[model samples]
Target: MVSQLDNPNLNLIPKPSHTVKGLIHIFTTAHRNFFTDVMAQALRIAGQGTPVLVVQFLKGGIRQGYKNPTQLSQKLDWIRCDLPRCIDTPHLDDSETASLRDLWEYTQKVVTEDRYSLVVLDELSLAINFGLIPEIEVLEFLAKRPPHIDVIFTGSETPKSILDMADQITEIRRSHTP
Candidate 1:
């Protein structure tokens, strides 16, 4: 048989176009202070001129709402619930509940608008576990979000469904020193 390398039509083959698709990343830890790495990543990406949105579902006390996002840079926006204090338990007052619902709705709206390259949902798992946000809604949101937008979920005790859906999972464990 003749060598295939001698074929003259090899150069005429059309190359297939490849598109870049974003991935779902999950960062989990048993402690609350394990998100420094995630924050650093968000800042780094924003510093590189890519749009990033960080939403703190359970963090509050600053009265920062969706409309009053703190702009860390030209490309980064951080938003928190409009509560008077941080959420540590499932029980919430009517006003606090309303605030969280509003924030969740706003997050879905802006994420659907395809305005950011990376979106970080901080303490989202905790919110879900607390029943503040519906897990079904979150799954639906993930399904309907733009395919090119990368999403990062940070919290402890992440749901199995969300963990299974993640393309990459990072678990941080602290080593106790005696």
Candidate 2:
């Protein structure tokens, strides 16, 4: 498969090498380590002294799947919105509310402020699908978002508008081979 980074259109915040820096979409129906894979790349970038922020909107109870090295303290920021399960929390209503707020606030800050080098919005597609966040709003945000900051969106379903606007897209699928 061709890497998204290989896409010529992805030159938004062109590196010295000329690469895009906004809206990376990774979708998958397979139960795989897509988040882990992306986080690993974020870690690598952070290692180089670039700021990285990762926010996971799902409340799966799994905390940051990666270790936070002290050396990268100021370089990396990771957060997850995994709400606990309980009868009172039917369908994660609380989580949905909390994440919607968090994503809105943080995402706005990231795009408008240009504080981080890379911002990974894990499971953001889920938020969009759940109607917690509007796709058009995000698209508008991206259009106005600083060109120097790179952002990523990961989940199973991707809207056509997003696909058309993105600089790169990587789709993950489960292997059926026995």
Candidate 3:
């Protein structure tokens, strides 16, 4: 056999470059009102200097709205629907519907523009289930989001499509009655 140190084809293969991509995390429970852990995690991440956005989809009563996002920290933003009461059902007045649509559109815009390193969609499942937001649109948004941005979905009755896309799923359950 001849000396094999003269192969030129090996150099044609391109080397893989290192790229960091974030993941989808889903937190679900059988009942509502249990996202303290997710909130804490968002706060911790924001405290570390990574930009974070928290959007409460079905929650209201404070009139926070998309234009009036509350800055929790230097790198954290919190927003809610601009309604006089929290949404627990599918029925919505014209103004309420408009508010939800505005928030949803704003969220998609910011995420697509790569504004945050992490995003928390609080009560997203309820909004989707109640027909306030379209699931297909959400899927498209997730697929097109910046590669380095992590997303967290927290709510009860999370749809199968969203759960299927999650890299991590945490289901919360109570051990005792309150």
Candidate 4:
């Protein structure tokens, strides 16, 4: 799907292929359907046998409204920063967050080792915003990532540097009813 950002002159569209290289996707939206968006897009590509690594920086399980996609594909890997919990009890903690270095390490390993073709950095912007991670280091990783890897970023308050590096950018706005 192709969408326009606030900049009318620019359009954001995700086009991927095994041969595609150095692609970046930034998904910025207040709408709650982004998981579906992420899942649909990632699954299709991963289903094609391209490895996809998903990292969720949020401090909780999948949001209530989002359907967490299964790791049905052998090529898909999901690494979450939140602690696991049963549905009946939500483990609330202030210190469960993954450190900036840890996230950076995972990203670096994926990129430097060429373990994945697509990477989804979910809520990474929030981490950067809260100073949970160093923005410069993340930017450096993105800049140095192998040309064959494609990256997708999802969250509110995306950093401008990220937006500047994006090969495509999409923004979804919430609808209100009176």
Candidate 5:
């Protein structure tokens, strides 16, 4: 009456012994699947009250097709909050700006209050392109996060500065010209 879970031949990846205090991981396409798997595991741990935050840097038009691997959408009950994407830009009128500001303020309040077990920032680099904040500034913000918080940064072509700050670096490279 033995089960697969009790099989001695199985090799189970070790989980974090205790809740993660602080961790920073940088990964590229060559290691995308491994990185994704690790993130999924961390999210599972975070769901058990580890205080997790995920900041994904997707190229413009990329994230629209992606789905949350951890089922965080259901776990966090996240609602989309649109920002101005710029201040006084010709495209957005004062009314639009005001609305965007209000949305931004509301979202920040929810995040700071820990309303969700996880917060997903999809395609944040696209917003960075709008000059909302410098890439390094975001990294600094992440580094200064409270020890109880578990922050995950995911992107394709991450800035070198941010990558340097990461504790774990996984580079997934594919040969393009062979």
Candidate 6:
């Protein structure tokens, strides 16, 4: 059952639960500023005291740049954090060297240890597409995400499985005929 909402030729479907357990967003272009703004608004809707996990999917060089960490902190300043280095490198290349179980284990560690309000995976699709990260691990990460945490995945390309399971699917695209 696909539904549409008011937006730029995209679906702004309402979330089924105010306490959303997981979200997978597909952006067909590079729109970081817009994505971040919308995400902040969505997080605000989460139930009081509920933690949000955002998995941001950045494209191209953001991963190599290692800048999403600091920028995210500034972008979501309403939330507080100790400000650990963003985009921990171990998880970057390990997607190639490590198995899905290992990636799941690492994600479990971060989510549990940080007790994060949101988990953002930036440029996830790109990482998997480029073989920098394993697809199975990505799925496992999605599967194992806790109910208390809100998980978000953003990128230009998303896997069919992820899209199939999405409670809310948001797509950002340009108006070719506009």
Predicted model with the maximum lDDT: 1
Question: Across residues 1-178, which tens digit of lDDT does each residue of candidate 1 receive?
Answer: 7755667788889887764788899999988887788989999999999999999999999999998999999999999999889999999999999999999999999989999989999999999999999999999999999988999999998999999889999988878955
Q: How do the residues 2-92 of candidate 3 rate in per-residue lDDT, one tens digit apiece? A: 8768779999988878558889999988877677888899999999999999999988999899899999899999999999999999999
Tens digits of lDDT, candidate 5, 1-178? 8755666645576767876565565545523344456457656756676544443332212221122222353343322323323232325556544543444345345555655444445434344555544666566566555544444454455666776776776655666655
RMSD of each: 6.9, 10.6, 7.2, 12.8, 9.9, 13.5
User: For model 4, how does the per-residue alpha-carbon lDDT over 1-178 read when each residue is reduced to its tens digit?
Assistant: 9985686544556555566576888988875467778967888988899898877766345431112434658888776643453122223245444333454576687678988888888888877887767799789989888888889999888889989999999887666755
Candidate 5: where is the Cα deviation over 4 Å?
Answer: 1-20, 30-39, 54-121, 129-132, 173-178
Model 3 CA deviation exceeding 4 Å by range = 1-16
lDDT per residue for candidate 2 within 1-178, as digits (tens), equals: 8755576677776567755655554544445367778888889989889888887666445432223212345687876553442112224466457644664676577658877878877776666777777888878877887877787877767777888877778877756755
Residue 26 CA displacement from its true place in model 5, Å = 2.3
**Which structure is stronger by TM-score: 2 or 3?**
3
Candidates sorted by lDDT, best first: 1, 3, 4, 2, 6, 5
Model 3 clash pairs? Answer: none
Clashes of 5: 3
lDDT of candidates 1 onward, in order: 0.93, 0.66, 0.92, 0.71, 0.47, 0.51
Compared with the true structure, model 4 gives a TM-score of: 0.72
Ranked by TM-score, the better of candidates 4 and 6 is 4
Q: Give the TM-score of each candidate.
A: 0.89, 0.71, 0.88, 0.72, 0.47, 0.52
